[model samples]
Target: IHRQAHLVEGFSEPFRRAVEREIRRLGVEIWAGCQVKAFGPEHVWLSDGTELIAQTRLWAGGFQVPSWLSTCGLPTGPTGALLVDKYLRVQGSEHILAVGDCADFVWGSRLLPKIGVYAVRQGPIAAQNLLRLIRGQPLIPYRPQATVFVCVTVGNRVAVAEKGRLVWRGYSATVLKNFFDWLYMRKLKPLRWQEFFY
Candidate 1:
């Protein structure tokens, strides 16, 4: 369970905080600000010079989208993110488009963060721009109105919420995060028996 703990941790702040809270509730203390320097067959090394000989370790680090846009002959940023214009069209190709994790777009002064929320917003904008191109109409610029909410699991009986500039914490927040997670999954995959499984 610890090995796969990152799956929940990497999802969102609410989830991670909730799980951490539970771990502490179980009497297991965790250290913060400790960075792992290396992993070997029998031990893990930390930046602080601490070593732990554990049979298993889980990386709760996070995720990155596999991007090979340049190999496909498209221009990409240093991070391999496909560079697209306002219409979500690939930088050098009028007919080519990029979306979701592979594409990178700037919203005003901010480089849009990679998250599922932006991908959901990009789908329709990309489709609209594609349609306009086919019909020879003026293309609509994809202006994403971005908002993010994060819930993190804090060790036992507490969670944290970052909804806009607002923040909240405690057990109520944890319950709210869990409920929202259930709602999101159900909305995405309505056929799943979320209430039973989750």
Candidate 2:
């Protein structure tokens, strides 16, 4: 059961369903929305008065912004996301730019998921805006796309791609996903091909 780092919110539902389906296929009893309250000698006590005994426990709840972000003095919102203007510049810094997961700009005030595609698209725009700013030229506004492709692994050697109204599955999707992953790695870490390929 390996859920990659980028799976969040809507992206998690399919992965969770896949896990549940696989577990059911194996004749394993699976429970949803069961919150564990305390750890016992060899089991877990649930808030709903249920006991689950297992030798291994897998925790995959997801991660949050690093703790040190607060000490860095960046203006963070309620969820600890760094606030940035449309130009992808930090609120108080004229020259400082923000990109990737660090920028908290959202469309229509909705929070954007911290995904690779968003970061990839933002880098060039942020760079462009920064260059224009340095040259005292007009800066371009950053506009995030509403829909993005997500290729998720469903165990085995299979994968699925989901976008606005598009869905594709199986080996072809897996191959495309692998290709896209490789492309991103090569682009982001061009000089370190050995490190990325490995």
What is the C-alpha local distance difference test score of each model? 0.70, 0.69
How far is 135's C-alpha from truth in model 2 (Å)? 3.7
Provide the lowest-lDDT 10-residue window in model 2: 1-10
Candidate 1's displacement at residue 134, Å, is 2.9
TM-score of 2: 0.70
Output the lDDT of residue 37, model 2: 78
lDDT of 1 by residue, 115-190 (tens): 6667777888889988988998998888776457766666565777666656677777777777766776776676
Models 1 onward score TM values of 0.66, 0.70
- In candidate 1, position 178 carries an lDDT of 73
Best TM-score goes to which candidate?
2
Off by over 4 Å in 1: 1-38, 46-50, 153-158, 178-184, 191-198
Candidate 2 residue-wise lDDT, 1-198, digit = tens: 223322235454665455445445556555555567777568977767888787787776554677776678878755576778888888787888887767777668576777778888899999899789889998898888777877766655566677766666666766777777877777655654443222
Stretches of model 2 off by over 4 angstroms after superposition: 1-36, 47-49, 71-73, 188-198
Provide the clashing-pair count of each candidate structure: 16, 0
